[model samples]
Target: MDELDAWFPYETYRPYQREMLELAATCARNGGIAMIDAPTGSGKSSIVSALLAERAGKKVIVAVRTISQLTTFIRELELVRSRKRTLAYSYLIGKRSLCPLSGGGDVYRRCEGVKAVSTSLMRERAGTGQLVPSRDPVIIRQMKKLDTQHPIICPYFIKSRVFTGGDGNALRMLPSTTLRNRADRITRERVLPHELREMGAGICPYEMLLLAAQKSDVVVVNYHHLFDDEIRTQLYGSLGIEPHEVHLLIDEAHNCGEVMQGVMNTAISGPALLQAEREILGLRRQLKQAVAVTQIIRNIGDFMEGLRNSHEAEDWFDPSIFDRIVVRGSLYRDLSEVVDDLMQISEHIREKNRAAGEYATTAVEVLTAFMVRLTCSAPDPAFLTVFRRDGDEIVLEVRNIDPSGRLQELARSHHCCILISGTLSPIESFRRYYFGELDVMTKTLPNIFPPSNRMVLCAGDITTAFSMRQNRENTDRIARYITTFASLAGNLAVYFPSYQILETYAGILEGRLSSRNLIVEPKDARDAGDLLKTFLSLPARGSSGILFAVCGGKWSEGLDYRGDLLAGAMVVGLPLAPFNRVRQMTIDYYRHKFGSDGEFISYTLPALNRAEQAIGRVLRAPEDRGMLVFGEKRFLEPRVRSGLPSWIRDEMAECSIDSFAAAVKKWK
Candidate 1:
């Protein structure tokens, strides 16, 4: 038997499962980066088995974007442990989910303040005769004295641990036996974040998970735990794990660039400046540098106002002009000096607020962080400074155009990195866009599901181009196509390029489709969940429904439409972003970096990916039969056609609206 057999939970291998396992094993043995473009239902979750087989002593960290994905791996690890009961695993999500304390503040900063006070009180009690400070009478009294609504110290953290009886030199701390027992139970059972929170009535769930992670062979975390620098540093430091000792696995690898960009981006708004100026003035007598900081804040506001007057919505702003305003308005000689003063004042205010049991983040701290990023990223061409109107306020933003440099740094810092996603088609484009010139291994697995179960059609007559969208003839054609598809037996979803397009077609077909239910995706996300619940119930009631949604919106991705729930889907057009100044600047930056292929790689590929994601909602299982329609003439172009997955390209039929109606009528 092969060594990997011990880790494999199931006795049978689906098509290409053994091959993917072996490739992952090899990648783990030889340290570097590897990208895998495996389709859904290819047993991508089982790749963790191969990593476990090869992990000699290093810790494995699997990062996911959402809670559902994290739960999927937790179940998979449980199966692996069924084969090897001694294998242990744990997971860590955001603090907002795990924390028991509630207040209007940044969770991380609030956690820091509470943990500091909790640890200090615990140590003082331990200095006396009380070894377990949580049970100490004096400590309990102090904690009870704090306001229940907004306590400065955390009761969960205090109750989560105990200290060894000794003096300062020989003192030590350990997880309470009760918390350790719960941690052990989590390794043995399928405990989700909410479940763990319930289980932790009196203990800190995060502390319990940390205790489990320290002894386990594998640890699961959210994407921010690995993508953000401060979070990564704090997580690694707590785990006592170093860079070389880490083996990283990133699921939904397609979101890597966007997530990294979010970490690097920073902004300050006009309203924020007003609040910061008020804060500085309130501290004028005590803060020595208050006058200089207040002037700088006012000048920055004026600078943003000037940019807003010159640009319509969003456009590039000169960083040199910003620096000149700051230095000329204040006593500081350079931008860095002003940033240092802001940082100092922000920290002072934070400490003062924490001492008063008010853990809210001040507006000045937000400006301080933005200025720091602006000063630090000015020389890098990948970072673009722009001003845009958001609602009623003008905001200045520093956006990171390309994430390849940060991705490269993250990949090289680890022992071995594996990024896997179901939608990473045209693997070469993604590799170039993610790693630049870095030597990275790549794989594109074949579609394991039978091709007979699904049919794809690309329109040859209709187009949703900007110029033709308003044409009465083109609008009627689109309405006719949707009304025809509404005659099908089950739920049909049509995704448009934007909400405006969706509303245009929806308005034309609102009362026209009385035979079937018409459900349109809401702009507000809080209302979307309830509407989705309504959409999913139509098949069970023996009723048919047609949904109008926009690509890249809430309903287009991260959803599971299983058998009969979604019988067919249509992507109305290429879901390109709105052509605006901000988008053009991003395209121009990429063109400079990637030469001729810049616009296609940066702009076109993402739109195609979003379209595929919407269509891929159908055919979730091998036995599931469904129809997919690409509702635009541009899909027939060679460049766009070639970028689709081979499975889609092979089964696709190019048709006009009349032919599409004929095909749907004849479809099984």
Candidate 2:
């Protein structure tokens, strides 16, 4: 047995951590993909870091699903470095996420609340400081500097100064009177030129990951960026690198299939079409007098009329008929024509009015973007769809559908690949859907905590469907059952399948439960946050209450109500998403592709995973005392129970929730 201090330096290895490290090291050595199924709080990051240390020179990309997860990973890396200082690391974000301040963008606007003492102090400090208008020549010089080396950073201060001045030489040419006025405005507003530049250049975390991946040894990003076709192509193809060269480590691997489906699916609506039509109309009105422009407008009007008559947007249109409607050829040629026409009309529409000229220029830029998005074909699997609005108009939506196969091809072209995750279970399913083969090696980590820490109870009587609605009699029975459990538990989070079910249960428990017991439902995200805050603030011991939440909701996943803060949970249904038009279409499409069983594989299974995630929220720490109760009877069936994890099944076998009240009373 290896002491925790030997390899981990943490004094002990949690069973799951040891297992995860073993699997990651094996995958790193063998150069194969591996999926790990381990619960949260299992020190997965530590295991991965150990694996990365062994593979010194190679780049590793860890793709997570949320900003919170990315932040945690970075913090964990920082901790690891503190313990072992041999690692070299840099955090990369998308080109757009780079600090505008660092890039020389005037980001002064973002520092509004921070008090600025005096301009003289700012001028004295040469290095990075919180001075409002730092006058240190070197710092000022660095702030003014602009280079293409950091493309993501925006020189917003430079841009703003030029924009406000109306010319590049505005600062130099300013008269003393005007200069004094500008200076006064700057001081009073506390607006620093350098600060404004920084604000504009600020990019999001997703963009940061993309940028970091290029140069950093380890890159952390959201799964959506790598899995989504449009984003993946932009990252790999544009970077001139094969996918396999960069290793991928997905943190929450279980959600990959569902995330892939979401990325591939696209939707178009009526209101969207009308908005696009308005833009087209504005463009047409701008060039009304030109012969070509007039003809194009007339043709578009005719097309809109035909679309209105048909009342269908999905019907295909002949490409030849619309070819003349769209301008093509070289980008320079398209820009030249638009500029020439605008110049000819400049005299008619007084250039003296700056706003008019600005509008025309802005329109030209918008048109340019539209043209590029329409013509670019370096990427593959591109498809175009059109829809019609109630107001006799047409809208077009273009997308790259199903980029997985292309991504796989890109991956195969690389020398080595590693796919690691904490929740990559039922490995065969992921292999079949993502890699199209089961050739990749698989591994599962042992549970980190003792089995007795958390208990799962399939309290198999809670039902909301018509046949088993909790009526007057059943409501009392259900309320009594929950009350009994709450008395024994510290904090309980009960999940209903829908808002209707939640409201129904809440009404039943109205007077029976104490006012101190906070009950939350899906009214809005803000409301949910408040409810969670109240629930967590309760004392760790003897904090008896009910937090009413919906299954597969915002509260279910990405939330931590661990330890004594959350003691028990009740799940009302299987969380099979209601069959709507879009879900039905998805089921039908997958069924046609793979068969009837495919729909369950595609839809039902994914929804069930979400329920599992919700239940997983309670049992966060090793010492956390928690029990999961499933209200739905269907969960007891072999088909549903078979898919559940072995640990969960063992917990369920102990005591079903149908006999919940008696069980709780006996335990108490």
Candidate 3:
């Protein structure tokens, strides 16, 4: 294999790349589900890509959390293709974003009038230098005919006319016809790869997965597309297939439970309901002119009053109970009638304001749908939340709880599923929530970085109780510690739990550390980047300064500040989220679901994951040297410390921070 490796661009695998790939291959062969817990820079991409390349006949779908990650994976795949000269791939974006023109479809006829006028202008310029506008009804009719069928395609010719200053020269410039001819020839050959087929080009990746499941071997998408109820229904409903037909690979599987809960939970607040009532009332005022609007407004008012009354009875109304109040019989009968009334009035308003056009209709439809969905009874959890903003107006928000079951059902129907991520630890929790009865294979790869090179420190006394923002004495102590620490370190990044804490600590250290370079996380992205750049570029004196940041924020993850760019990290707090009603309710919800100790599964564990993610930021490579400072005292607790990975525990036993200044002195 080493000798054959000359054919590849990269010579070696990173950490457990081969093992993960082997597992993936085994899973592929047996048609079983596999969950991989590989850390960042662990070459998970190569492992997955290898599996994809080997499995030519089987379509593999890769789903990630963000579009940016998807794009990155696509680029990595492209790089592999460049080296291996095997496998074919194409990007499938959301269906709404698919280009109708690119697919050789006649979906642009809606803009035929513009197309015709533009074409006429082009022709007139071709024959004569003067621009000519056409108003002939016959030409207009023909253009309208073309527009109705090929709106997206015909618009190019129209746009060409505009670009060419109403001259046909742009159209005459050719190449499109030649390209089309080439495409036609290619299509006839059938030798072109399945990925080259024009069939699934314009559909969303999720939709494309459904369409090409039997054909293409691999599909990639975000976590939301697979887990979100709306997207899941759309894909499954359109494909008419069960989830079991597809293999499951959940990348970033650690966040699966959180994503599942997020999709499943729905909340509506009192203030938002009140605002909706006002808006409905405003529409009702137009009732003298539009009876439909008036009737719809009255119905909305009734619904709002019922919602308020339900809330008044209890602080929280279970979605099931609320549904019993709103939805009756079939067709969402109550809300459906309101939708009909609103739709009628909206149409009238649209006609009256032709300039307003689709916007008016769209708004009406959105509101109508909202009302209908609000009133419809579903098995999902729903909550009514109230928020008070300034200016005397209260906001109400309504949301559904736990859409994960629906998503999982959809995934099972599809067959093969893959969930991948760096942070999925204590994998059982995620599996219990996401896969449930579905059998799943799990693997956790060792940290990609060599454990010996990086030093992890856990300060025993750093607690939120002693946090600077919460206590002035603690602020002074932290500042003194940081100043002394900077005297020894070349470069450092100190992470705070929140912006308030960062600001408070930075204020304490203001004038004392003038000689030392300092960078603070700005409130905005561009500013933050700028600060990081300044810090990175600063001359590396034997003892440099600090970069202050917030934990679990943009700078903490998705950043590489290795070597001298970052020498030490002062983690001020455990990153436990502040106490809030919603968080309390979330804790209660989990407690009810999984017993009293379930709060650990629901809240505490996730918070610890975030702290772990922050710690991960400092150690980019095995050769990097960094000191991790945990300022929170609660982290010393047995329960909290137990949640940390084994490697972290081993490191903490060796390098513990007693006093901030003393800990700083020991960094080197």
lDDT (tens digit, per residue) of candidate 1 on 424-539: 98888999999988888888888887877777898888899888877888778888778777776799899999998998888888889866788999998989988999999989
- Candidate 2 per-residue lDDT, tens place, 1-668, comes to 33223335465666657666766666665566666666666777775465564454566667777656677677666665565555434333343333333322222222111112112223234123422232335534654553333222222322222111322223121112322333333222322223423323322222222333454455565675577666766666634565655555667766665566456434333343343344445545565634443343344445545666664434544333444443433222333354345344433332322211121222222333333343442233233433334244454333332334644653454333445544444545555555655356666555566776655666555555555563666555566666666676477777877787788767767677765485776667767777677777776544556788887777787666755777777776677765544355556655765575556565656656766777777777878776677766677877666566656666675344456766666555
Task: Give the residue spans of candidate 1 off by over 4 A.
Answer: 167-169
| Model 3: lDDT to the true structure | 0.55
The lDDT of each candidate is: 0.86, 0.52, 0.55
Which consecutive 10 residues in model 1 have the weakest lDDT in total?
304-313
TM-score of 2: 0.66
Q: Please give the ranking of all candidate structures by lDDT, highest first, separated by commas.
A: 1, 3, 2
Q: Against the hidden reference, what TM-scores do the models get?
A: 0.97, 0.66, 0.69
Give the clash count for each candidate: 0, 36, 85
Q: What lDDT, from 0 to 1, does candidate 1 have?
A: 0.86
Regions of candidate 3 where Cα sits further than 4 Å from its true position = 1-15, 53-56, 66-68, 82-84, 92-219, 222-248, 257-393, 400-403, 465-470, 481-491, 513-517, 522-545, 562-565, 654-660
Q: What would you estimate as the lDDT of candidate 2? A: 0.52
Error of 3 at 478 (Å): 3.7
Q: After superposition, how far is residue 386 of candidate 2 from its true place, in Å?
A: 12
